[model samples]
Target: MPQQSAEALTSQQKTTSRRPAGTLYRGREGMWSWVLHRITGVAIFFFLLVHILDTALVRVSPEAYNAVIESYKTPIMGLGEAALVAAIVFHAFNGLRIILIDFWNAKYQKVMFYVVIGLWVVTMLGFLPRHLYNVFNN
Candidate 1:
C-alpha cells in the first residue's frame, strides 16, 4: 500500500469539498409558499394581538379606546389595513392549497406557487382601487 503525500491529501480534500458541477438547488414552489405563508401568518398574528389589546382599552376607558381608533383612521393605518388584508388573504389561500395537497394528493407543487402568485395579484388589484377611492374621498 502506498501512503499519500501531503500535497496529494490536500488535492483530494479540495476535490471532496467542491460541489458537483451542474448541480443546482432547485427549490420547489410549494416549499417557498409554505415559508412565506408562515412568515406572513406570524406577522398578521402579531398585528392582531396589538389590535386586540388596543380595543381592550375601550373596556377600561372610552377615551383611550377612542384615541386608538382615531389613530387607526389615519392614512398610515389604511396602508396597514391593506397589508393586513393581504396577509390574511395569502395565509387563507395558501392554507387551502396545503389542505388540498394533504388530502387531494395533488402533485402540482409548482402549480401551488403560481396559484398563490395569481391570487396575490388579483387581491391587490381588487383592493388597491377601493383603498385609493377611500383615501381620496376621505
Candidate 2:
C-alpha cells in the first residue's frame, strides 16, 4: 500500500472531521439558556443588594434614604429601570421555561433558541407601552 500524500491527508481530514452524530451533547441551546439564566440572575441579585442597601438607609437616616431616592428619579435611573426589567423578564421567563421543561418534558434542548427570542419579544411588547406611558405622564 502507498503512503497517503499530504494533499490527500488534508482532504481526508476535512471530510472526516464531521460533527459526531447525536443529540449535540454539549454546547446545546438548553445549555446556553441555562448559562444566560444564571448570569442574569446573578446580575439581578447584585442590583437587589444595592437596592436594599439604599432603602435600608431610611432606617439609619431619612435624609440619606431621601438622597438616594432623589438620585434614582432621573433619566439615568430610567436606564437602570430598563436593565432591571430586562433581568427580571429573563429570569422569570427562563424560570417558566424550566418549569415547563420539568412538567411537560419539553425538548428545550432543541427549542431553547426560539424560546428565548419569544420571551424577549413578548416581554418587551408587554412592558414597553406601560413604561412609555408612565415616563411621559410623570
Candidate 3:
C-alpha cells in the first residue's frame, strides 16, 4: 500500500482484466469426451448387471428366461439395443484413445477425439441398417 512498483501494478491489472474461469469443463471437447466416457461406462455397467441377472434366470427357470428374452424383441427394444451399441462403440474407441494418450503422451487428443467420432459413425453406419432390418423384419 505504501508504494506499488510498475511490474506489480501491471501484473495486478492483467489479472483483473482477464475473464474469470467459468464452468467446470469450459464446454471443451475434452470435457464432453470425459463426460460421455463416464456416462457410457456407468450405462454399460448397468446393462451388464441386468444381462447377468436375466441370464442367471435360466438356471432358475427356463420359461422365465425365455419370456424376458422375448420381451426384448420388440421394435422399441431394438432401438434401445442400437443406442446401447452406440454407447459401447464410443466408450471402447475412446478408451483406446485414452490408452494411446497415456502411452505416447501425445498432443493430438483433439484430433484423436474426432477420429473416434468418425470411426463410431462409420461402424454404426455399417452395423445399423442390417441390425435394424433384422430387428424390425422379425
Local accuracy of candidate 1 as per-residue lDDT tens digits, 36-133: 89999899989989989998998899998998888888888888888888888888888888888888877786887788789988988999899967
Give the per-residue lDDT digits (tens) of candidate 2, residues 48-132.
8998899899899999888888888776677678778988888888888888888887655458557766878898888977876
Q: Which sections of candidate 3 miss by over 4 Å?
A: 2-24
After the best TM-score superposition of candidate 3, give how far the Cα of residue 124 lies from its true spot, in angstroms. Answer: 0.5
Candidate 2 global Cα RMSD: 4.9
Which of candidates 2 and 3 reaches a greater TM-score?
3
Q: Please report the TM-score between candidate 1 and the true structure.
A: 0.78
Could you tell me every candidate's TM-score relative to the true structure? 0.78, 0.72, 0.82
Worst 10 residues of 1 by lDDT: 19-28
- Residue 122 in candidate 2, Cα distance off native in Å: 1.7
Lowest lDDT block of 10, candidate 3: 19-28
Candidate 1: pairs in clash: none
What's the CA error at residue 110 for candidate 2, in Å?
2.5
- Candidate 3 structure quality by residue, lDDT tens digits, 1-138: 536687798889998676437755654667788999999999999999999999999999999999999999999999999999999999999999999999977588888899999999999999999999999899
What C-alpha lDDT values do all the predictions have? 0.82, 0.79, 0.91
Worst 10 residues of 2 by lDDT: 19-28
